[model samples]
Target: MNEKEIQTEIESRVQKKLSDLFTTYKTDTDSLQAILKWKPVVLMIGNYSSGKSTFINELLGQDLQRTGQAPTDDSFTIITSDGSGEGLIPGSTLVSDEKLPFTYFKDFGEQFISHFRLKKVDVPFLENMAIIDSPGMLDTVTEKDRGYDYMRVLGEFAKLADLVVLMFDPHKAGTIKETYTAIRDTLPESSGEDRIVFVMSRIDECDSVSDLVRSFGTLCWNLSQMTGRKDIPRIFLTFSEAMAANPESYSEWKEERNQLKQKIQSAPEFRINHILQDIDRQVNEIKLIAEAMNAVARKGRAKLGNTAKFGFAVSLFVFFFLGVILKGMTGFPEQTFLAALLGGTVQMHHFFVPACGVAGTLLVTSLLFTKWTFPRLRQKARNSLGNLITLETDYRKNLWSKVENRVNELLKNMRISEIWFEHQTNLGKIVKFLNKDLQEFYERIRKIK
Candidate 1:
């Protein structure tokens, strides 16, 4: 199917099946839909002077971004085509545009917005895609230094992009603190494993093939440590041909550059599948949350049931002997209600006082449970949230890790009991969407030529 047709089909399926699920579970569909509506995005991230912009310029066949050995650009510049001419849009304006998927960036504050922009070019290569060029990652740089969290901003962009190219140079070999943090923490949360391509750019600068091999080995070891994945992802070794005077000398790896460029161009092809996977992952996250809530609800019900049982026993005792206890304590109304009952001297007028006493006892018991007992139980459940869900499998554990904070936030700020009962039903809907409707969508996408 064509791009528009595929996009429409995905949208139709989500609206018909998963839209309500997203809203009920508090997932943001606006950002998801906004990402769907825009052109496919290719996010470029790497160390300072890692040839990210240089490679982008090569792909666009023009000098669109400044090139330098040091960190050249500090702004997040989005380069795309309008087919008219060159133009620029500021970050403040870009975030306000509902048509784009960048509204979340406004939360990063004015300092970050001042460093964000969009550049429109007339290049044919960008007619169907947009390239986001980020400020290079640096070592030992704190969030206070940037006035915003760099890895966080990267993660947000990574979440929206169809393809993320993490470029590196032979000089650094992925040892930078920020780079380590991104691989270790951010990408796993934002982008899927398949969406990121590891590229070791500027390989030609190595003194020898052996030197290059050592750098590659170092990078592999570091990646293993950072990602904790035994299998190392494919890393493209490339260099800018424009900067290579001895092009013939580096002919062996020149085709790798072309292949990387081709991969970037093919980002649009990745768009549909990426969207499907993103939606699936998000829906599953909501499902995981619902499961935890169901656990909390179960705990809560058990606690309340125990309390009710105890309270019922107390109420029965009060109903039978309250008058006797009162008479014993104050020596008033000499005959107990039980004494009247056994002696067969009870009248309808005599029953009123004891009946009222039993009713008042029950009311006080209910009030104590509601006001004092249940809140403490809820707080205890919140404290031991890890015990709520059975994360026996690795996948369940990982999913729990992702939504744990969100669940904690909800439990802390909201009355979870009020909303907890619907979770079981929500779980059913989410499961049906994932196992049935979403699988059908996957099949339909696969059938597309």
Candidate 2:
């Protein structure tokens, strides 16, 4: 099947299998909607004069975005093709259109929307995908300077991007404060490491090969410190063909530039994997929650069984012996029922009154357990929800953290009797979807051209 057909099937299957669970757990579906509605997106972010726009322009083979030594643009521009002709779409319109996946940007307010735009071009490269070029990161800028939370906005875009290109130039060597913050704190939480492609752009600007080596070393060191990894990630060394001063000297690096461009062009292919992983992650979260609730249900059943057994035993003893105890204490009864039975003169008719007493006692006990004892058990369970499931792995722990509050809320508000059957069914559905349906989808995607 084609990309659109696969996407449609994914959406249909997710809605069928997990929509109710998402609503119950309060999992946000906006990112899923964004992925479904939009073409594959490549988000570019980097320090000022890091050659992000220059690199994009080179990829498109057009001088679309302004290029300069300093920061030339301070807007978030989405470049795509419209097929009708080249044109521009205002950010206000972009955020308001229901057909587009950008309605969530309305939360960023009008100030950010004013700085956001969509640039339509009649380029073949944009026909299958879209590219988002962000305002360059700066050391001196604060949230107040931008009149918006830039890191938050960037993170949101990162969550939706199929591939993220983090461009760095030799001049900065990956030391810009905002870039450091983004690499350290933002992208890790928003985008997966596999989705990010690190690039050392504008390497031709170095005076010599030794200078380039030194810059590359500095970048590697800074990235190690920022990403907290002992081993270095792959950093593509690239320089724009049109901007190279010593063209022959950097001729060997042209292939690197072309490879980076090819990587960006492969975003559409990556989008399917991203969608599948996203669905898998979300379903796994729900599965963990189901397992937690199942644990709670099991504990509830055990407690109820023990309590009922104890109550029944006490009631049975009272049925046979309560009349004799009352006669001994009050000194007003005739021969007690147990005494008469022991004398071998008791009749079936003589047992009817005590039977009535036992029935009353059992009914009262059940009411007390329902109205008082069960509620206290539920409260205790709710308070110690962390003990419900054993998080054996870091991945399970991560999933638990996402749904911990939801589980807490469920225990607080939902009855234990109501939790067991439904959540068990939900768990089965999630497991089946993940193991069978999702695996089949992956196989189908692998067959795609």
Candidate whose TM-score is highest: 1
Which ten-residue region of model 1 has the weakest summed lDDT?
Answer: 183-192
Candidate 2 off by > 4 Å: 67-72, 139-147, 170-192, 214-233, 328-337, 344-387, 391-397
Off by over 4 Å in 1: 1-6, 16-21, 142-144, 175-177, 180-192, 329-337, 340-354, 383-409, 412-420
List the pairs of residues colliding in candidate 1.
none
After superposition on all CA atoms, what RMSD does each candidate show versus the true structure?
Answer: 3.2, 3.8
Question: What is the C-alpha lDDT profile of model 1 across 234-281, one tens digit per residue?
Answer: 899998878865666679998899999999999988888778777776
Residue 250, candidate 2: C-alpha displacement in angstroms: 2.1
Query: On residues 29-69, what C-alpha lDDT tens digit does candidate 2 reach at each position?
Result: 77777777888899998887899998888788888999888
For candidate 2, list the clashing residue pairs, or say none: none
* Native-referenced Cα lDDT, model 1: 0.79
